[model samples]
Every structure is written in structure tokens, then in C-alpha cells.
Target: MKEYKRFLLYGLVVGTVIGFYLIFNLKSFVSYENIFIDKTDFMLSSRLIIYNKTCGLQHWKEKKNFGHRDDIPFFSILSTILSSTEKKIIIIEFGANVGQFSERVLSIPHKIPYIVHSIEPVLTLFHLLRNRSRTFKKEKNDKHFHYNLAISDQSGEKPIYSPSQYGEGSTLGKAFLSNFKEIENVTVTTLPEFIKKYHIKTPISFIKIDVEGFEPEVIRGMNLSINAKIFPLFSFETGETWLDDRSVLAKEYTLKSFVEMLNYFQYDSYFIGNPYLLPISGTYWKNSFDGLRRNPNVLAILRHSQPWKNLKKLLNRIPFTSC
Candidate 1:
């Protein structure tokens, strides 16, 4: 009888301890204050705000040759065209660093059979792109191709600077300081050569050119006549700074020159940003150019004709201004 009473006492103590533990821990789980402080206050308030704003919706978190922003207007316009049209789209991306833009392009909703051809001169970056292309191809089935070559005015490989020490696929021309070595000299070819090689007689939908400071050379190599055949859209990167040097060009390439060059092909050009038009006195250009040269960040979109009218309308719906 005494032993039974002792067992009952022991059971009561264990039950009380278990009850207290449950009350303390489980209370925190169900408490409104806990939810407010832990999940709502921290996760939603702190982390989500910056991550969603900068990376998730803004799409600027990734390390791209061009700093991140929302999707490029030209790409958005091209996606709209591809979504609407029955024609196959071919995108040739020059200086494709880690296939960031190519990945974004494939993500757009479209039924048009699209082929993305990416060219990267740097060996390490080419390997990264090759791997990414394989993964993308495995998922999508024959949608992308990667090549290791430097696109120049003529065919024949030249000295390529592979700065593996930088640890990023995309490096500004001035940022490359790694050891120089002889990489397989894949002869540079023009856009026409690419089209012929691929048997892509269809209308070329888009061409994204970003070869650091070598933009002019790539432009000169391409046959603009082919542009007439396909009405291809171009998005090239240019800056006032020469390769690997912060020293500004003596005579920098101006928007006016770019406009004149494209105008020769009857392509109307417009600068994409808050101020739709270039400033009258070129003060804006001088300041912005200097700012970007020092910081090495800034992206401007050039489109054929006023293709961004729809985009401008869309931007008006947003509460904030663009960079």
C-alpha cells in the first residue's frame, strides 16, 4: 500500500513537470506576440523587404556584367514579340558572362522556338557558361548553346586575358589583372558568319552585345544588312572609360554618334531611363559618364524606334522612378 502511494506521488511529479514544459514551449508557438515578433516582424519585415525588393522582384541581386535592374526593356519588348509571333527567335549574346541574361530570356513565357547562342572568350567563364547551358538544355531540351570565342571584326583568335583570380565570371575590362596565357584562339566571326553556320535564315529577333570596351569592334564586324533581313534588335553596352583604365577617353563615344550610326541603317534610337531624352547641353552625359567610369556601373538601353512606349505606360503604374 505504501509502495503504491509512492508510485502515485512519482507519477504526479512527472506529470507536473511535463505539463510545465508543454505550457512554456507550446505557449510560445501559439502565442500571438510570438508570431508577431518572430515571423511577422523579422521574416516579413526585415528579410523579405530587402530580398524581395532588390533580388526577387527587382532581379538585381545577381552579379551581371551590367548591374542588375528589372528586366531590360528591349528583352521585355522582344519577349512580347516572341509571345505574339509564330516565327522562331534567335538570340546571339556576345560576351555572355555566366549566362545571366540568357537564363532570364528563357524564363519568359513564349511558345516561339528560341535558340540562344552565347559566346564567352574567357576560359573559366566559358566553362561556367558551358555547364549552365548544359543544365538549361537538360531542363528545356535544346534551347541554348555556348561557344568559347572572342568576337572581333575578323576571324582568328587573339590574346585573351583570363583572370581566374577575380573569382567572378564577368569582369570589367579594367578589373582583369590575372596572369595572361595563351587560350585556344577561336577565330572571331561576324553575326553573318554565325547565321550562316547555324543555317538561321529566319528573322533574327534579338542581339545582346556586351564586350566591355570592344563594342565598336563588334559593331563594325557585323553586317548591318543582315539586320535589315531580320529587323534584329540590338542591346549593346558602351561607356566613356576605356578598357581596364578609369582614365576617361579623350573623345568618348556619344549618344549622338550611336544615333547617327544606327540611323544609317534606318534604326531609330531612344535612351531608356527616367529622362527619356538626352539633356540638351550634354551636362547629364558628362556627369553620368564620369560617375559610371569611377564606379563602373550603369546600363543604358537602346531600341530601334520608339519601342518602349508600352513599357513607359507600364512604368507609370509603379509608384517609384527607375534608375
Candidate 2:
């Protein structure tokens, strides 16, 4: 009996050590905050496991807090757009899932007049976003416009492939079809068309694109020639394995083409986040795309962009890594 008790005590000690080791290693996976929580993901997972017994549906939950931890630093970079512009700023956000980032933008303490055009195509997510934006406290002159449409190269109904577990995975890219199990038809709009339709005259300050692998389509929708005077800062998601040939959009569309398009439109590329924005050389961009150090997001700057000038001075004062 004593020997059995001794074995049990040793097993307990080993289990405790293993648990702590796992927790320490897992901490590296979560960026920014020590805690990771996605209300929608948790709700959907619970629903699937406890009630539905299926994980084929993605539903929306009210965005009560900043859903992503990374947004804290990302928004700080985003605020530079407003600081650079003397005129009232307008922010256009594509793929605004549940308005978490928009909420962060709205919460920033600033007296500058600003408006947010939050676009989310998914019906369920759009509903949650609309609700959240309505209740958010806005500064005097701060306004928000919610659009239930997808920003793409064309304006029409498009089949957005969505995974049951993560609605944010929904995309207009045909290449992403394999990752998603369900098809959702969403109304699509071009940026130029949206501006015209709404008669938005505010000086566009920034645009954030998170349309999964279909980012090239969003870039195509804009009329850069006329908007060059506004010269808004552009930040967007560059998906993992951007060079993967299996991606439906990637088969025909390459990351190089996307970068070249921005270059043709008079925009320079930079790697942003990590509190400092680093200018990405053509070789570095290519190497990054080829999988040296995968960056989830990149920023585009115009030659005359006032923000880039101030951003350099501001970033230099802080200590940060090139993430």
C-alpha cells in the first residue's frame, strides 16, 4: 500500500510539472494580451458541442469588448491617420466582423472630427455590428455609418465562402472555398461606388481591409487616380502562405500583383504593428511572402502622405521590434 501511495504521489508531481510547461509554451501563441477570448468563437463552440452537435453554422454575438488584443497597438498606428489630416477624417473598414476594431477606433480620445464607414457583409455579423455601433459613445462630430455589403472589385451578389466555426473566414475568393463548408450570398460594393452612392465628401483618412484572401479585389474597386489627392493610408491583411497556388484567388492572383497594383497607384509598402512601422523593400516583401517571417498585416503609404513623415519621428522615440 505504501509503494502504491508513493507512485501516486510521483504521478501527481509529474502531472503538475507537465501542466505548467504546457501553459508556458502556449503563452507564445497568444499575441498582445495574456488572456485570449473571442466571444463569438466561444459561443459557437459551446452551441455546437452542447446543443447542436454540429459545427456547420456561424452565428454572431454582440461585441461587448475589444474582441482582439492586437487592436490596442494597431489602433494606435491607425490614429496617426487622423493626426496627419487637418480636415475631418473618414475611415473605411472592410470585413468589419462584429465591429470590435471599429469600437476601438470610436473609443480613441480625440477632438478631431471623424466618421467611420463600417462594412460587414455577413447578415448575422452585420446585425451585431449595427447594434454595437449604435450604442457606442461618440465624441462630438464623430459619426459611424454601417454598410451591410461586401467591398470587392464589383458591385453585385457574390457567393462568400464561410466556415462554420469562424464566420470571419468568409471571403469572396474562390480559392478559399475548400476552407469553408458553407456558401453565403452577400451584396458586394466597390469603394468608389460606395463613396458616390453615399455622396461622402469627407476627406478620406484611412482604409482598413481584412477581406481574407480577396484583398486584391478590394484594391481593384477603388479609383486611385482621382482619390490620390486624399491619399488615405491603406492597411490590410496579407494571409498566411500568400504564395500558395492552391488558393482559388492565388491561382490567378499573386501577392506580387497586389503589391504592384499599389505601387502603380503611387503607394509604398510597409510592415506595421509592433508599435513601429518598417518600410518593406521589394526584396524583403518578396522574402516575407516566401515565408521568412510571416507578417499578418502591411500598410501602404503615398509619396506625399503626411502621416508617414510624423510616423517615423514618433516610432523612433519608442522601443519596438519589427513584427
Candidate 3:
């Protein structure tokens, strides 16, 4: 009986030592690295915060945050495809708006490291975006970068307005606002200047802009980079009418003008129809006020570029009815 008792005490002592060793040294093998809360994979030992706000993705009377319906599946596939062909997969999204779309892109697992630079002009939204990016925690070369300044044709400040802190219908004009919150004198910089300031010399895989009818200024501002072929594909949101931003510029750009610019740059515009990217004809402007008629998400890809060629083959991979 004494010998048995001695053997049990030894077993207990060994177990205690093993537990202590694991407690002190487990971090070496196990990753306690900070990561944003992705649906499937996340490390939780230590992280400042997780950016879980759905950015109005929550359906009415429904509990699930379905995520940005059209974006996630498409961009995820786009990133996956482009990562195979491009060395540094850099994606820049303007008007990132609280990092909602950015989260959708960054959360998904990628074959290789990719970079997303989110640009938000609204100060409050920018801060929220910065916080969300902080928890994303750089993984090797893959990272999320955010900027607070608006990009335009020149350096200056502009009055930016929004319906709420969540940033819907954020525009430079108060014409569309009903009980809107306005921020006076938000700083603005040209896109090329911004790229130079950040020393971003790499070619961009994709670009996105949602400046609420400010595409004229944005397109002009990005012309130098466009000419330089820094980005192969870009997407932007359009206003209700072909010419809504009359108050925005010394010269407002009509939908026809926007189309002209695309042709000028050898880019073809298409409307995102869930899994499909339907080409927009030059006469699409005459159909309705909404840009590309009812289609708001405009994808412009450099003509015959590898990204454009690759996208043609990837449409079948995107789920048709997810959105």
C-alpha cells in the first residue's frame, strides 16, 4: 500500500511539472499573434479589439450579418486568382466607409499574402477604420493600411456630409441630406501625391472608390497613376442620376464623360450582376438616372490586361445566388 501511494505522488508531481512547462513555454509553438475575428480562424490569447460591426450588413428583422453580398465572394476569388499571376497583390479601396468592405476582403484566407489599403475621408469613419485595421494584425507581407484623407484632383479641404456615423450617402453636397451630419474642412490630397507620400511604388492589382458622385475628381486625380499602369482594375459606386455632382467641381463630369474617360484609358466598364460582370454599352446612360441604369457597382478593367483576361475565366467560380 505504501509503495502504491508513493507511485501516485510521483505521477502527480510529474503531471504538475508538465503543466507548468506548458504554461510557460506554450506560446513558443502556439501562436498568440493578434488577428481579427474571422469566421473560421482567429487567435484569441491577446488582441486589443475585434471590428465586428456589420456596417449595416445585418438584414432587416434577420439576425445574421450576411456580409457585403456581391463583394466578398467576387473579390475573394479575384484576390485568389490574381495572387497566382501577380507578385504583390495590392488592392486600394477609396471611400472604404468604416472598413466594412475591407473587412470582407481581409478576413478571407488567401493563397498568398495580399495587401489592402483602405481610404476613408470622413474623420470619424477613418478612426473606426484605423481601429479595425489594428486588430487585423499584419501577417508577413499581408496587411491592412488605412488613410484618413480624401483623394481629389488637388490638395485642399472639403466639407464632407453623411446621414449618420455609419456613412451612407456621404457627399460633398448637402443637397441630398435629410438630417445629415456635416464635417467642415476635411483635408484632401491628389491620388498620385498620396501614393508618392506613402512611397507605394508597387503596381496595384485592383482599386475601388465610393466617393458619392465624386468620380470626376477622383478619375482626374488618378489619371497619372492610371497612365502609369499602377492599377489594372477598379470599381466605383455611382449616383442616382448621370449628373448629380453639379455642385462638386469647377467642371462636373457626366456619366457620358465618365464613360469617355474609360475608353480613353482603354478600360471597359461592366456592371456587377452577382456572379456575372455584364458589359455596359456606351448608350447605357440614356436608359435611366441610376448609373448603368439600375446597376450601381461599376467595374472598369484595363482592356485585354491579364486581370481582365483572368476575370473572364473566374466568373463561374463565384456563387450566382449568394447576394
Candidate 4:
């Protein structure tokens, strides 16, 4: 009887510890600002000044490049487009892992008033984004905003695959590389739902999506924004393998289907680093897949946008290249 009692006691203690741990994690997951980090957070990287620390084994040596700088040209174009309009600019970034792109957008000088909704689904990465956002706030800069949830076609729970490459291959679908070792179930919210919930009244001017292979579902969730004709300029990542799977989303939202949907909305596409914008009826559709895999980041422009006309003038000053 004593032995059994001791065994029960041990089991109770172990269970209590696990329960506490889970509660703590849940609290942190819901409130990203609770674990925010700032200038005094890191011990090293003092003189040279580095950005957010990554999830790699050797954090000291990991390259801090998050492709934030690459989006500067796009922002410049948006600035020119909104030069005269008094419409409040809102930038929605779907896969804002570590807040790098958000940092670039917020840190730079803006010609017009803008707000950024930087959303990250993964709990671990969301914390990193909040920490980076806090750092930005510490500098007396306050344009960057952070959200801790996934944006999908529905608002519920979905399994997210986390690969061994840290933030490199996490996705809501199982189409990730075979080397993924962790699977996390994350809460999801749609764009219109989020906008309504947050009372965001401004029009979205730009969006950068890098959600592995989950961009199509993200697009579907933005039907409200699309139908309202507030279609924002998009910088999206595309690849052949993203649609190669037989998943329901892949089957329905195939590359051709998505392009057609964009056409229905009167969006013209262009390869970034190219001076010329591909017309809505151009032959660029045939090479979209090839361009997607090789270059990945394609710019989608609204064909009838008055701002696009002014933005096109600036593109002429820059060199054109095929992506």
C-alpha cells in the first residue's frame, strides 16, 4: 500500500509540473508582448548591432538576413502611388516571421501615414516578432504592429508543420520537406475577420506573402478585401511543388486557377526587378510557373490603378531584368 501511495504521489507531482508548463506556454502564446526583448536583451552583437536572433543551433553565426531590404523598392513604388491620395495606407504581411519585413517597412521614412499588420502563426516565431517589434518601439518608432495567429480560409485550428530548418519550411499543409520533426496545431483567423475584429478602417496598399505553400488559402480568406476592390499590390512566393500535392487546396487553388482568379479581379502581373509591367492579357501567364520557381517573388499590380500609372514612370528609370 505504501509503495502504491508513493507511486501515486510521484505521478501527481509529474502531472502538476507538466500542467504548469503548459499553462505558462499558453499564456506566452496568447500574449506575445509578455516576453518582449529589447536592446538590453542580447549579451553580444553590441557594436555591430544585429537584428532578431534566429532559432538555429549556432545563433551567433546564423545569418540575420530576412529579405527585408528587398522589399524597399516596392515600398518606394507605393509611396509614389499614394503621393497625392490622402487614403491611409495599411500593409498586411501574412508570414511576417521574425518581423524583418515589418521592421524594414516601419523603420524607413514614410511619405504617407501607414500601419502594418505583421502576422506570424508559429508561437515560437511570433514571440520573436513581438520582441523585434518591441525593439522598434524602443527607438521611438511605432508603425510596426504584430499579431499572433495564422490567417487562413477559416477561423479555427490547423496543424502546422515545422521543419528542422527553423523558420525556413514551416507550413499549414503537409507539403513541406520530409525532414520536418515537429508538428504544431495553431489558431487561424481570416483577413476580413481580423480587420473587423481590430477595427482596421484603412485600405490595404501592399502585402507580402511568404507562407511556404499556403499563399492560396490566404488569398481565399481575403475575399472581402478583393470584392471591395481594395486589392493591394502583392509580393508572393510561388513554386511548382506548392501545388503538386493532391491536397484539397492544391486541387482547387492550383496555379492556373489562382491566376484566373486574379484576372477576374483585373490584376496584371510582373516579375520583380523588371522595368516593364506585364499587361493583364500578356503572354507572361505561360511562363508564370517557370518564373515562380526560378525567381519566386512576383509582383501583382492592379491594372486600372491610377497610382500604377505614376509608379510606372519610376520603373522606367530603373533597369529591367527577367526574373
Candidate 5:
């Protein structure tokens, strides 16, 4: 009886210590993958930085060629089309992974966007994005805003799952990655609700969304904004593998829903091909998209928008087609 009593006492003490340790060090335990890479040197690079630091370990690297930058074709086309004097415009980026899209958009060189608002949910990536935005803010003061929240249909808190290998795959929906776990719970808000909460009276001019399989929910939340007179240009990831997994989101709310919504708004949708943005019409989207692999981005443009109006002229100078 005494031996059993001693065993029980030891087990109780061990369990208590473990429980406290986990509670106290929960953050460090969850971010265990950061051990492989140095956290400090991961930010924007210096012009005179000596080494690459990527010794072939990390998948991403810093772009120090902003001085002589070659912006993405889609952004370049939009910049050429939009008048340079067009101020008071806002660019909202969803699933803003470390502000890569924001950085690229702001660095477009020709037609400058008035401001860029970036939203990210992953704790580590959000911190990085907030930090990078500071540098961008320095160059273009008050033009960059960072939000550490997820954008979905409702406003509340939601658990996000992500895999260590694919940190940017953080999603409010089911994580389809092979090795994924519940990373954290992020505060969620609808796009229009967020704008109303912040009292943003300015009209949104552009939007880019890439929320893994949760694009449907994000689309549903844009009910009022979609019908506004000046429809915002959209470049979203639609045919991703996770969105069509059946277990991720319903069929009616997946790609079909996005296309239907675009059509309702009289917005033309295009497949952001390798270099060409091929238009999707009739039953093209039904047979074209192959979500199993990494699919191309989608560009939705209102036919009456300024950019679409000037697209023909820009096409002559800055060719958008590969062939």
C-alpha cells in the first residue's frame, strides 16, 4: 500500500509540472519550426547585404531589386490603365502573406496606389507583415496599414490550421496539407463590416484575395461592395486544390459561386495564365480549371471600369500575352 501511494504521489507531481510547463511555454512549443531559420535576418534585405543567408534551406527570399524593379504583368497593366493623378484610392489585400503583394503593388513605379491595407492571420507572418509595413510606411508615410485578422463571412474568432512546411497555407477552413495542426485562433470580420468599423469613407479601388479554401466565405461577405457603382478590380485565387476538396467548402459556394457572383456584377473574369489573362466565358471555367495542381490566379474586371477601357492601348505597349 505504501509503495502504491508513493507511485501515485510521484505521478501527480510530474503531471502538474508538465501542465504548467506547457501552459507557460505554449507559444514556443507551437512555433517550434522557427528553430531552423534565424528570425531576425528574415526581414527585408539591405542593398549592401553580403550573403544570401538562404543556404538552400528556406523556400522564400528577400527581393532587394526594388530600385530596378520589374513589377508583375497584371499590376503593370493596371498601372498603365489607371490615370496617374487618381488619388484617394485604396487597395485591400486579403490573405496577405508577409505583405509580399502589398510591397509589389506599392513598388509598381508608374501609377501609384493611394494606400495599401494588408490583412494577415498567421501569428508569425502577421508580425513579419506588420514589421515590413513599417519600412514601406517610411517610404510612403501613412500609405500602408496592417491588420492581424482573418476575413470571412462573419465577425468572430476562428481557429486556423497550418503546416510547418507551408506556413503561408494558414486558413480558417479545413487544412488539407499533409502535416497540419491547429496553429491558432484568429479574430474574424467581414470586409464591409471592417470598413464600417474603421469608418473608411473612401471607395476601395482594388482587392486581392488568396485565402486557401475560404474564398467562398470571403466572397459571400462582399454583398454590398460588389454592387457599388465603382466596382473594385479583383485578382483572387479561385481554382486552388483545397477549395474543391468537397470536405473544404460546399460546391455551390466554391468556384461556381465565384463565377456566378462575377457574372451578376457584370464583371468579366479571366484566367491569369502564365503571362496571358485568358477570358472565361460560356462553359469555359467548367472545363478549364485544374485545381489539383497550382492553378493560375483569376482577374475580375468590370467592363465599364477605367482600366478595362484603356486595356487595348496598354496591350500595344506592354504585351500581356505570351504567344
Candidate 6:
């Protein structure tokens, strides 16, 4: 009996040691805050915080706090591409899941002059976003418009699966066909109709899209020539696989497709992260599970053929040439 007890005690000690070792070594992967705070000196101070509290653990919650300086990189890059004569800057965001990114933009300093238009299709998410935006305190000059519709190649309604935050939320937008088998109708809109209905004037600035597997449709619907004259950047989320659905296409939607689409529009683009090393490309397959299991998101910049020529002579002092 004593020998058995000793063995049990030894096992407990070993388990404790292993747990502590894991906590120490894998601490960085536990949260973005730990990684960011350790790597940079920047600070964020904003009320809109995303708390992954679907689970009960406190430390397990991942939080993102936005602040003024956070907008510096985005603003500087954008301002360099746009002319000062441009009076109004319009930002169009599709599939704004719950306004998390939108709230981050709204918190930026001296950002009141721009107008934001966000489109979200899921009913539950739309309500959450509307509530959050309506309650959020902001300057009167900053205008925000929300449309509870999905943008696709064609105009019609289709059922979408609005899953609970805990139960495979990653597959929320993709499983629209299977999950909503009974409900065969859902509201969807095309980009052209939205632009016409919104009465968007020329000289647009940015377009961010995050729609789940329907990116190709969204891109096709837009008039690239009109966009080039106005919008300068397109930041979007891309994935290699479409969630199991009827609309799934043959070519897995990927960063390569994003490049091809932009090239078709005559836009030169670069990726934020090394696509070759990303999980989809199979370079980092071992860590693929931990990588972006959902679609990997990227930012694509579109510049005029000769943006430098459009810039004022004095503005040449600023670094406006390269990305």
C-alpha cells in the first residue's frame, strides 16, 4: 500500500511539473495581449473591447483595445494615395461580423471627417452591431451607416446559419445552405445596387470585405474602373476552402485568387504576411490547426498607375511612392 501511495505521489509531482512547463513555454500563444505587449511599446485605450467570454474563464478571454495611434499607419498610408482636393472619404465594409473592426476605426483620433458604411447580413450579428454602434459615444461629424444585407453577385434572399457564439461559430456564415434547409429565403444585395441606393459620390477611399466564401462574387459585381478613380485600397479575408455548401466553387478561394482578381483590375498588391509560409500553402502544416482555421485575412492596396504625378509638388516631401 505504501509503495502504491509513493507511486501516486510521484505521478502527481510529474504532472504538476509538466503543466508548469507548458504554461511557461506556451504563454505567448495564450493571448494576443501577451504577444503584442512583449513585442511593442504601443498602448491602446478604447471602450469597445472584444471579450471572448463565450467560455467562462477570465484569463482565456482575448481582448483588443483600440486607440488613436492605432490609426496612424492606416491613415498615413491612405492619405498618401488620396489627393487633398478629395473632400469626403467614404469607407465601405461588407460582412462586418459584429462591428469589432468598425469600432476600432471609429476610435481613431481626428477621424470624424470620414463617413463609414457597414453591411452585415446575419440577423443576430446585425442587431449586436447596431446596438453597439448606437450606444457608442462619438463626435457628431462622424457618420455611420449600417445595412443588414449580404452583398453577392446576384440580388435575392437566401438562408444563412446564425450559430451560437460557442458552437462552431467559425462555420456560421458558410453553412448557410445546409443549416437553413427549411428556410429557403434570405435577403441579399449586389454592390452596384447598394452604391446607387446610398447615393455614393465619386472619390471613394477604402473598401474592406470579409464575406465568407463569396468574395469572388463581390469583386465581380463592382466596377473596377469606377473604384480606381475613387477607392485606393481593398482589404479582405481569403480562404483556401469554402465551408461545405452548395455554392462551393472548384478553385479553393485563396490569396492567389485575391492577387489574380486585383491583377484583373490592374492593381499591384502585396501581402501583409508571407503567404508561402502560411498554413494553406502547406509550408507550416504542423501548425496549421493553430493557424487561421477560418479564412486568413489580408490587406490589399490599390494605387493609381502614376499616383506620384497626381500628388502636389510640396507633398513630394512625404514618402508617398511605395507601399
lDDT of 6 by residue, 240-276 (tens): 3344453344134444554656666666543222111
Top-down lDDT ranking: 2, 3, 5, 4, 6, 1
Q: What is the lDDT of residue 182 in candidate 5?
A: 77
Any residue pairs clashing in model 5, and if so which? Answer: none
Give the alpha-carbon lDDT of every model: 0.50, 0.63, 0.61, 0.59, 0.59, 0.51
Instruction: Count the clashes in each prediction.
Output: 2, 1, 0, 0, 0, 2
Q: Write the per-residue lDDT of candidate 3 for residues 1-323, one digit (tens) a residue.
A: 99999999999999999989877753422342211223343343321111111211122113222222455455755564452225566778888877877877777766567678888887778888888777763557787888877877778887887767666657766664466677545789877788788977556777887776676677778874446366677877664523443336523565556666687777777654333444453643343323333325667777667776676455333342332
1 or 3, greater by lDDT: 3
Which regions of candidate 2 fall more than 4 Å away from where they truly are?
1-72, 83-86, 174-176, 241-249, 252-257, 283-286, 292-295, 319-323
TM-score per model over all chains: 0.57, 0.68, 0.67, 0.66, 0.67, 0.57
Best by lDDT: 2
> Which stretch of 10 consecutive residues in model 1 shows the poorest summed lDDT?
47-56
- Candidate structures ordered by TM-score, highest first: 2, 5, 3, 4, 6, 1
Writing each residue's lDDT as its tens digit, candidate 1 over 1-323 gives 99999999999999999999878854533442211122466534221111012221222223222332223533644455331123556777888888888887876666567777888877777889888765553234336878877776667655554335433423223333445333434556776676688676545566777675666566667756455535345655544434454213313455445445665665544233222222112222233333233212222222322323333333222333232
lDDT of 5 by residue, 1-323 (tens): 99999999999999999989867744322333221222465344211111111211121112121111122445755655553224655778888888777876776663344667788988889889988876653334337788889898889998887766345677666534556677888999988888888766445677787787676677677773545444446666654444435234434554555666677777777655322344453344444243323445667776656656565344323322211
Between 2 and 6, whose TM-score is larger? 2
When summed lDDT is taken over every stretch of 10 residues in candidate 6, the lowest stretch is 275-284
Model 5 C-alpha RMSD vs. true structure (Å) is: 26.2
| Candidate 4: residue 118 lDDT (0-100) | 90
Query: Which has the greatest TM-score?
Result: 2
lDDT of 4 by residue, 1-323 (tens): 99999999999999999999868844532342212222473334111111111121122123221122344445544455542224456788988889777776676665456677898888788888888787763233336678878887889988777665455557777643565555677889887888889887645677787777777777777883444355546767666546546135745664556666776776665434212233222443453344234424556666646545555444323332212
Regions more than 4 Å wrong, model 1:
1-78, 82-86, 137-142, 163-184, 240-252, 272-323
Candidate 2 per-residue lDDT over residues 1-323, each given as its tens digit: 99999999999999999989868754422432312233476534211101110110111011221122343466765586553345677788898999888888888788787788899988888889999888887898898999888887778887766765446667665553466655578888888888889987745688888876667667766767777656457777765534443244444655566667677777777545344344453543444343312435667777556765555334323332222
